[model samples]
Target: MALLLTFGSYSALDGGSRPLEGNALDGAVHEAGFDHARVGEAWWVLLPVVRNRSGADVEVLDVRVLDLPAGLRAERYAAFDAEETGAPFLMVRDGGPEFPSGRYADRSGRPVRLEPGEVSRVYPAVKVRVTGEVLGEPSACRFTYARGADRFTQVLPCGFTLRLAA
Candidate 1:
């Protein structure tokens, strides 16, 4: 059985200028029945699902992750196969504020636009690595998606808790 991470209902803003309009996009971490304290290694993986329910083509800026804890590590993966399998993932980008566009933009360095019924995935892998002091515990991580001046925010459930390896 496949886990449904986000079931984003589509809407247009400013007479169809933006793809996702004012909270049309929603997100949640789909990992079920997993606890942190018993786990060993962990990764905060982010995957983008762009659904174009509108009749016309709409281009959307890639979603952004913000306010991450200092100790946790991050990485990104891009679509390899033309088919949106959401698989064969590879590390392509890193985390931080400077590269908000790195995770979601297309080859043209612009927001990825989709036609009707098209879906695309933007993957970012955040690994929890403890050197000396552990991350303590995983908390709710906040991420915001922006298109021009408008902004949308969502919280993904942290899959595993962070602690010292014993």
Candidate 2:
């Protein structure tokens, strides 16, 4: 199957700043955007990739999964990859591979700095475990970053609707 262009809504949290873009967004990284098969039956690896369209370097400080569906639980956010550097390191939704240095670790503080026109190959392994029947749900994600010492938080619409194959 091919990837699907899915739309989702987002909101600010923890006093996060609003995004420069619109509320509705598509998962440009993964195929079909969100997941594949059921959660329990499979673990969907979310390789969240985004480019810095801005004319400045975006220092992504932290990323957090704001809300999730009932039956689906966020398991682990592990490892990241950068196209500039072919390597893997321990990473999470909040913690990603360190830029300029290309060092990967299991911590939630280091920021993923993306330069203008630069792409972040963030392979954040999200274990989507399905337990029960679930309806279409929205998964909000907050990305906090800095631009020349100016810190701003933008929320993205990473929601998805899960259903079994007929």
Candidate 3:
């Protein structure tokens, strides 16, 4: 039997002229795991794998983090095929152990292609520096993609939480 890992749910956030309300993503929670990041140091956290369940091939246009609390900044670093990479998904610095060989691709310059049933794991490098002890608020990510002539957006909670330490 094939193993399936469904860490987070996705919802269509398309077609709206008005800005999203403040509480739009309140219910979505990141349940995968947690980590402690030292203040002033950057860390890379693996986000939930994004699978192309759409019937057609989709081009992932962009990925952005939403609702991040103060003192934390997250940016998309790179993406790799989920099937080719194994976990311990936290990276302490650039070119860490989690970097995949030929399977790595940057999603910033060109859109990452995903055929139906293929999954891409996203890594967002984040930096946190705060006087607070812990951060418990959940942050979500918005993924924009184009399938054929149509463009779509989906939001899903990130997979891990970072507790800040000095």
Candidate 4:
């Protein structure tokens, strides 16, 4: 089956001036750009950016990968940008020997506030690499974000097919 994208919304924070929950959006994942370059014998590079123009704070708690030629599944846990660190709460697996599973705080992470007639960037990442056999195989990336107690998921089909170097 073709990958699917779901959007939703949430209410404002309990003790803050911003909204904590997000509502389902009404569109698909807007593709910015993507590239896969063979860096090593079996290593591939990937970079993708997705955005949510939803009127509220969108929370992505988990991500599910599907619809690829091969059977590969990946789940990610994420939280809203921390009030102190200003980073999107994220949980990732498959870290190499150097760094295993741990929390990541983005240096550019910032609280996004929208006005009555304004738009802001929801999610932003320009460089990300996926290793193993998935580097060059046709695959799909489905992501989820979360708020106080609410969550939203969005799936984006890759523009270019993934493959290994010949």
In terms of TM-score, the best-performing candidate is: 3
lDDT of 3 at 36: 53
* C-alpha lDDT of candidate 2 relative to the true structure: 0.46
| Runs of candidate 4 exceeding 4 Å displacement | 1-7, 10-47, 71-139, 164-166
lDDT of each: 0.38, 0.46, 0.46, 0.35
For model 1, residues 20-137, the per-residue Cα lDDT tens digits are 3343333335342223322333333434344544454444433433444555544432322234323523221224342243443333224454554566454333433333344444
Worst 10 residues of 1 by lDDT: 1-10
**Residue-level lDDT tens digits of model 4 in 1-166:** 1111224555445465433433343323333322333333221112123344454444333333344333222232222223432532121123443223343443232333332222223332222333434434434555544544444444555423333344
What TM-score, to 2 decimals, does candidate 2 have? Answer: 0.56
The per-candidate count of clashes, in order, stands at 1, 6, 0, 20
Clashing pairs in 1: 36-161
Model 1 alpha-carbon drift over 4 Å, by segment: 1-21, 27-44, 48-56, 73-110, 126-132, 136-164
What is the Cα-based lDDT of residue 101 in candidate 1? 37
Tell me the tens digit of each residue's lDDT in model 3 across 17-116: 3222111111223254335555554455554456666555556655566666665555334554444455435433334454433345433445656565
**Best-to-worst TM-score order:** 3, 2, 1, 4
